[model samples]
Target chain A: MKHTVTLILLMLFFAVPAGVLVLISLASGWRFPDVWPAGFSFSGIALFLQQKEQILSSLASSFVFSLLTVGVTFFMCLVPAAVFARNDFRGKTVLEGLLLTPALVPPMTFAMGLHFFFIKLSLADTLPGVVLILAIFSYPYMFRALVAGFQTMGEHYRICARNLGAGPFSILWQVELPLLMPAVVAGGSVVFLVAFSEYFLVFLIGGGRVASFTGLLMPLLSSSNRSLAALLTLIFLLLPVGLFFILDLSLMRSFRKKGMA
Target chain B: MSWTNNRAGRLVSGLAPLLLPYLVLFCGGIMLTICQSFGVFTPLPHAGAALDAYAKILTDPAFFSSFGFSLGVAMVSAFCTMAAGTFLAYQVWQLPAKLATAALIYKIPLILPHISVAFVVLVFWSPSGIVASIAHSLGIIQTMQDFPNILYSGWGLGMVLAYTLKGTPFAMLLVLALLVRFDVRQIQTAAMLGASGVRIFFSIVLPRMAPAMHTSFIILFLYGFGAFDIPFVLGESRPGMLSIHVYNLYFKHDLARRPEAMAILTMMFFFAVIFIIAYSKTVQRLENGVRKL
Candidate 1:
C-alpha cells in the first residue's frame, strides 16, 4: 500500500508538470472547458523555426556568457581555494563565512548597488559587466566545491609533485588540474546553471542591449501565446539537462580511462 | 620576522584574485548602497537630510504592508516546502534501492529555472488553465470561469505554490544527502522496542533531519523573501513583494527616489544579517535545551 501511494505521488510530482508543458507546446488554441488540448499542431514549432535566428542567438549568447562565468569563477577561486584548503590563519573562519555571504544574501540586495557602480565604470549593458556580476554572485559555489575537492585530494599529490621538482605553474597545470576535473565540472555545472537561468541580473545589467535566453523567454511567458512560451520553456529546461548529461558521460569515460572509476 | 612577513604577503597576493573582485564588487556595492541610502552619491543631488529616505519608507503604510506580505509568504512557503520535502524524502529513503533510484524523478523541478516553475503554476492553476479545464469536464465547475481564482486570490498563493514546487526537490536533495549516511539500525531498533512508526519518526528520524531542515528553511525563506523572478511572474502590483517594490522604485520611479530604493536595500541587508544571527542563536539554544532534556 505504501509503495503504491509513493509511486502515485512520484508520478504526480514529475509527470504532471512535464506533461502539461508538452501538451501546451503542441497545443493549438487549447481553450476553456477543454480537459485536454483541443488540437495538437506544429504551429508552435513552426513559429519557433521562423524566429530561429533571434531565439537561437539569444540562446547562444546565454550559453557563451554562462561558460565565461564558469571560467571567470574557476580562475577567481583557484588560488584562494588552494590557500583556503591548505592554510590555517587568523580570522580565516570569519573571512570564509563572509565570502560565502553572497550565496546567502539575495542577489537583488546587492545588484542595485552594483548596477549603479557598473554604470559609472562603463560596464553596464556590456557583456563583461554581466559576466562580472554573475561571477561575483556565484563564485562562492565554486569556492566551496573546490575547497572540498582540495580537501579530498589532500596534500599528498602537491607534495609529491613538489618533491619531483615540479614548478608551481607546472604542478597546477599538469598534476593537480587533471585530478581536479571532477570538482571543476561539478562546480562549473552549478555556476553555469545559476548564470544561465538568471533572469533579473541579466535583464537589469544587460539593459536589453545584451541578449539572453531568459530575456527572450520572460515576456513570452506572460503573453497570451501559451504554446510558444511552453516551447521556449522546454528548450530552457532541456539545455542544462543535456549539458549535465554530456558532462556526466564524459567525466565517467575519462575516469574509467584513468581507472579512477 | 621578515620571513613571516614575506609568507603573509604571499598568502595575501595568492588570494588577491578572488579577494580583489569580492572586495571591489560585493563589499564595494554594499558600501555604495549604504552611502546612497544616506542621500549621498545618488544619481541626483539630494537637497534633503540623510534620514529623508528612511523617513519616507518607514512612514509609508504600503512599505510596511509589502514587508509584512513578503514575510508571510516566505515563512508559509518555506514551512510547507520543508514539511513536504521531509515527508517525501523519508518515504524515498524507506523505498527499495531499485525503486528509490527511480524516485529520483522528484528532482525534475530542481533543474528548472524559477521562472519556468512560475510558468508551470500559471499554466496549471490559472482560471483558464488545465486544472480548471479538468474541473469543467468533470462537472465540478459549470464553466471554466467558474473556477476559483487561485493565482490572483490576493493571498500570494500562486507564489507560494511556485516556491514549494521549486523548493521541495532542493530540500529533498539536502535531507537525502544526510539520510544516505544515516544508520537504519536506529530506526529498526526503535521499531523493535515497541515504538510506533510515528514515534520513531519524531524521536529518531526527526532529529537526524533537523539540521538540513533548518538550513533549507533559512535558504528557501530568504530566497522567497527577496527573490524577484518568481514573484515578478506571479506577484500582484498592489502590495507587491519587497523585491518588486525595490525594483519599481529603483527603475520605474524618478531618479530622486533612488535613495529611498537604496534605503530599502540597506534595511534588507541588515535584516538578513540579523535574521541569520538570531536564527542560529535560537537554534543553538533549542538544541542545547533538548540535550538537557
Candidate 2:
C-alpha cells in the first residue's frame, strides 16, 4: 500500500508533465477556466513538418558536436585515469578534487575568458571549438567513471596480459577496453547528455554560425506559443533519451553475452 | 632509489598529456578571467585602477540582490530535493524487489534538460496555466487571474520549483546507489530490537545516506546557483540570477563593461572554491572518517 502510494505520487510528479506536454502539442486553444484543452489540432506537428529541414539540420548539428565531445573526452581521460588508478602520490586527492572542479563550478566563471582565448586562437565560431569547450567542461565525468572502472577491474588483468606477452597497446585495446565497456557507456552517456543539453556554451562559442537544436528551441520556448514550444520540447527530449535507450539495450546484451547478467 | 626514480619519471610522462591540457585550458582560463576582471586583457583599453570594476560591482545594490536571490533559490531547492529524495529512497528501498525495480520511473526527470523542466514549470504554473484552469474549474478561483502568481512572483519560486523537480531525481539516483549496497538486515535488526520507525530512520538510515546526501546537496546547490537555462525561461529582470547578470554584461552591454562582468565571475569562482572546502571539512568533522560515496 505504501509502495503503491509512492508510485502514484512519483508518476504524478514526473509523468504528468510529459502527458501535459503531449496534450499541449495538440492543443489548439487552451484558455483559462477550462479543466481541459479547449480543442485539439495537428497544427503543432504540422508546424514541425513545415520546418523539417531546419529542425533536422539542428538535430544533426547537436548530434555531431555531442558525439565529438564524447570521443574527445574518452581519449583525453584514458591515460590519466589509468595513471591515477595504478599509481599513488602525494596530493592525489587534491588533484582529483581539482580536476573535478570544472563539473562543480559554473561554466560562466571561465567561459568568458575562454571565449577571448578561442577568438585569439582562431577557434571561435567553429564546430571543433564548441566540441573542445564542451569536452573540457564535461570530461571530468568520463575521467571519474574510468577511474572507478579501473579500480574495479584492478591491476591483476594488466599483469596477466603482460605475462602473456601482450604489449601496452594491445593490452589497452584488447584487455582493458573490453572490460571497461560499462564504465565507458556510463561516462559517455553523461558526456553526451551534458554536451547535448548545453545551450549557453554552444551559443557563445558557436556564435550564431552553428545551428543547434537548443539554439532553435530556447527562443521558441520563451515565446508564448505553447503548442510550438511543446512540439520542439518533445523533439529535444526524444534524441538523448533515444540514445540512452539504445545504449542500455546494447550494454545489457553485451553483459548477457559475457554471462555476467 | 634509482628504480623508484625511473618509475616516477614514467608516471610523470604518462600524466603529462592530460595535465598539459588541464593547465592550459582550465588553469589558464581562470588566470585569464582574473586578468580581464582587473581590466588587463579586455578589447577596450582602460587607464583606471585595477580595482575599478570590483569597486563598481561591490557598490551596486543590484549585484547583492541578485546574489542573495540566487543563494536563496539554490539553498531552498537543494534542501527540499535532499529531504524529499531521502524519504522517497528510503521508501523505495523498503519495497519488495520487483516493485522497487518498477519504481525506476523516477529516472524520467533525470533525462529532461533544465530548459525543458523550465518549460514544464511555466506551462503548469503560469497565471493562465493548467493549475489555474484546474483551480477555476474546481470553483477555487473565479478566474485564472485569481490563481496566485508563481512564475513571476519575484521570489524566484518558479526557478525553485523547477530546480527541485529536476534535482530530486538526481538526488534519488545518488542516494539509491548507496542504498543498493546497504545491508537491509540492519533495518530489520533494529526493528526487532524494538526501535521505533522514526528512530531507526534518524539514527540508522540517515547516517548511511549522509555521503550521497552531502555530495548531491553541494552539486545541486552549485548547479542551481550557476545554471542559466531555467532562469532564462522563468526568471524576471529586476533581480536576475548572477548568470543572467553575466549574460547581460557580456552580451547585451558594450565592450567597456566586460571587466565588471569578469569581476563578478572571478568572485563567484572564489566563492565556489570556498564552498567546497567548507562543505567538505564540515562533512568530514561530522562523519568522523566515514566516507561512502
Tell me the fnat of candidate 2: 0.64
Q: Write the per-residue lDDT of candidate 1 for residues A139-206, one digit (tens) a residue.
A: 98899889989989999998999999999999999888988888999899889989999999999899
**Candidate 1 Cα outliers beyond 4 Å, as residue runs:** B1-7, B278-293
lDDT string, candidate 1, B179-253, tens digits: 887889988899899999999999999988887888789888888888999999999877899999999998899
lDDT of 2 by residue, B53-101 (tens): 9999999999999999999999999999998888888888787988876
Q: Model 2: runs farther than 4 Å from truth?
A: A258-261, B1-5, B279-293
Q: Residue A197 of model 1: what lDDT? A: 90
Candidate 2, residue B268: how far the Cα is off, in Å = 0.4
Model 2 DockQ vs. reference: 0.71
Q: How displaced is residue A108 in candidate 2, in Å?
A: 0.5
Q: Note the Cα lDDT for every prediction shown.
A: 0.88, 0.87
